[model samples]
Target: MNEIFVKSLPLKDVIANIAEALDTTYFNRCNEYILNIPEIYGEGSIRGINFLNGFGLIEYNCTLKEALKIHFNVNSIHPLKFIYCSKGSVKHKFEEHDVLHQIEQFQNIIVASTQQNGHILIFPKNENIHLNSLEISRKEFKTKIDCDLNILDVGLKKLFKDLTARNLFFYQGNYSLAMSDCIDTIKTSKFSGIARSLFLEGKSNEILSIQISDYEDDKKDIPKRQILRKSELVQIQKAVQILKSELSKPLTIKELANKVGTNPTKLQEGFRYNFGLTVNNYLNKIRLDYAKEQIMIGELNISEIANNIGIANKSYFSRLFKATFQLNPKEFSLQIAKNANKRQRNRPLT
Candidate 1:
């Protein structure tokens, strides 16, 4: 196994360490540590990790087969937390006492100051382990969540992931040493009571938001898989049935969330989680399917189909039908007609 480990003790000491690590021949060279890794590792593949601590981001693009650990001394004064993921499919064996729920594929894992005490195990694409670390300061985080959490909650995970995914976005914009200093500060001190509470609250709210967003995305994007919790599935089943029976009118997201006994965010999330599609996407799919069935009966035109299906826009409906089935509404109707004709022709000679 080939291993290269490097550490920087302080702002000034960083240079000496780098110099010492590289001898005279390999010296007179300039080297810097990237805050995130942007490549994947495997046979015939180039994998690397990068972190942009100054920009509050981390990313990895390699695989590992054993348990790996990185312990850092964060100044208690400024704590940091981030979402981490493997580039390709990777299994994580989080310590027994840590995870509140099971972690699965496409699952967003939170690495906060408190939950940072554990080993991260990865199933590698090759016979090696590669890791990267990103740093964010508690004070910088406070600025992000100082206001009410309602807005930031909607896309916390996305923001965190995006930060790591786009290294240039963070490192290219004056975030190099500034972020490093912030991280160094956190490694050595503690925070006051008020700041600590605010920080914890921010982390909790962000995590909740991340889960909610995933749930919503799933409901809209997924169709064949059952992914929601038992309770959420029960709620979605009820909502779907009710919506089907009341096809003449569409149910608003808030209404569906309320009827399903969940908040709008939760209801949407539950719908996504259970169906792998967002609530709106699933609802539209149901509406379109119903419309197609009605069209087979030859009782409605495009306008009627839209109205009956509770779609607001006739033009939009046509486009959506084409998009969904790769055929225009008229074409689809004619195909159905041809099928019916063929079936009639093949019917028993009675």
Candidate 2:
């Protein structure tokens, strides 16, 4: 495996050190340090930027030609790290430890080395790995104005205030939806220069807040913890596909759960958390939407449309359509026809 060592701090120097180790070079964009992967090795780039509040953001978006390990062995205390894997997987290990922890996609790990013990990150070759690291320089962060009382939990407060790095902390869990949204925003952002830097700085902090909250919620009892996982997301996708494909014969929540290889309760939770509605409601939406499409075609009558979408009673289907769209199926169809006629009448000399 190829190895690169970063022996620096404040993020910018960290990227510079990696560039030197690679025998390559890096560039600066609004104080954001970026090191593009050399063409001889692979494709993509890795970049880092430091904020004034002692928080830093680093993103690795690349597909290397071979396995690689980045060894961070700074002389001083290493910054607390919140590493998130958004695309491919990566492995983590403390420089002084022997055990390695694999962080897969959609997962995160909160780590604090024991008393200057550094960190080693391993990335597999020929994989599209996109990950971000949110680092906090505790020595500087503790002195920032935003690090006030009531901003953190008792243990987290202690963790932040521990400038000596006497304790070793390692936590791994699935990242929250809110954190995912923040990251999505960061990736899709179109800004550049100072605008981009300021925007990312704020979003990075927002992601950190959500990450800490996610950690706190994870510490609670199993029943009270609502953290979503990759398994649930897979189930949700399966459920959606079944609903859309078998529209004329929709299944009950329990039946759908069985079809998707999950329990009814988990299915319901997945629908609510991912789609913002219950399973039954989502099914109804699918049916109603299909009904509208059939209605617009002007081939199926109300009863036929209702039956085509798995609804036996036309009256009940009409009522549902009215409740959701403020217009009964018949009325909506009529409105569609009227708009079509008006447009035809207004047609020009063609």
Candidate 3:
């Protein structure tokens, strides 16, 4: 856990640009700082700023002496905030909506997005506020578990009790390393966008997995089937292995789970438990990954790759492929062709 300081807004801008390139409408114009929440939303407007565009999580450490400002709306939507208390207690003021509330000492807070714009605040004080945001997707989120909203406040508090010690010892002045690892996890996975949505929407599976991973590392005993359990942990590796071996075969959650000696429920839970994705999501990831490889090789047509990956419906497969890789199969093929042509032209005639 090396520590490196980062300015959040620039990172947000990079994410917004990527979202625009990917055509993610939700993050089309997400350009604002997390500290400046009001700028992200317009009064009486439906658009909310998308931090998910970056495809990673964020954390904050701050203290307030004034009441944080918030907006309100009449739309039925999701809640988007995770708060925790390390020292002083804070109060909620929502006349328009009954926001689900939680408060705990020395825990983490999570902020999720809803359908409409609303406001929330922590009691401003001289006390330092430490917060962490871990991006995740809806499918990877554990809505069925018992989660303390306040736990979202203390970033990864469930993993390490001695925040100062862990921060000082493990992080060892390399916060950027931690951030890099998180960003890499998102970039390498197919559940990239969904992970951000889940984190903002108070989805607990991502946080739980983080907690469980930390607990196991610390040699702590947890009773439930945590995400890091050996049986559960192996499914992701198995899915990846199977996907790599059978890229040309049709994949189903039931089949994959059965092959790994687990049911769909456990398979789904565990796949997302260790990785920030469900079984099906992982399958899509592999399909798309292979699609890219085939394009680069330029030995297969779009339909061939689609059908080979068990995507019989060309239109739907094309859409899913584009959504995952940010380019239609044709476009991807053309780009690869362009690169090959460029290389060939640059080669000296023998």
Model 3, residue 81: displacement in angstroms?
37
Residue 167 local lDDT, model 1:
17
* Residue 254, candidate 1: alpha-carbon lDDT: 80
**Candidate 2, residue 60: lDDT:** 96
Compared with the true structure, what per-residue lDDT tens digits does model 1 show for residues 155-245?
4434443322221111101111222223334334365445633443344344334444444444353342223333245676788788788
The residue ranges of model 2 lying beyond 4 angstroms of the native Cα positions read 145-155, 227-231, 241-280, 290-314, 322-350
Residue 206 displacement in candidate 1 (angstroms) = 12
Clashing pairs in 2: none
| Cα deviation of 138, candidate 1, in Å | 5.0
Q: Could you give the candidate ranking by lDDT, starting with the highest?
A: 2, 3, 1
Candidate 2 lDDT tens digits, 228-318 = 5553588789899999998889888878877887667667778888889998899999898888888889988888888878889888998
Q: Count the backbone clashes (under 3 Å) in each candidate.
A: 37, 0, 35
TM-score of candidate 2 against the unseen true structure: 0.80
**Model 3 lDDT per residue over 1-350, tens place:** 11112122233542343234323433332232233222222111112233332224433344433333323221333233333233344443333356534333333344333333333433344444434434333322333222643454343443223311212111101121122234344334444345545534333334435543443333323333223333245556776788778866756777886687656665676666556797678778878888888888878888888888888899998899789878888887887788888999999999
Candidate 1 off by > 4 Å: 1-56, 65-67, 73-79, 86-134, 138-265, 268-285, 297-350
TM-score per model over all chains: 0.35, 0.80, 0.35
lDDT of 1 at 262: 56
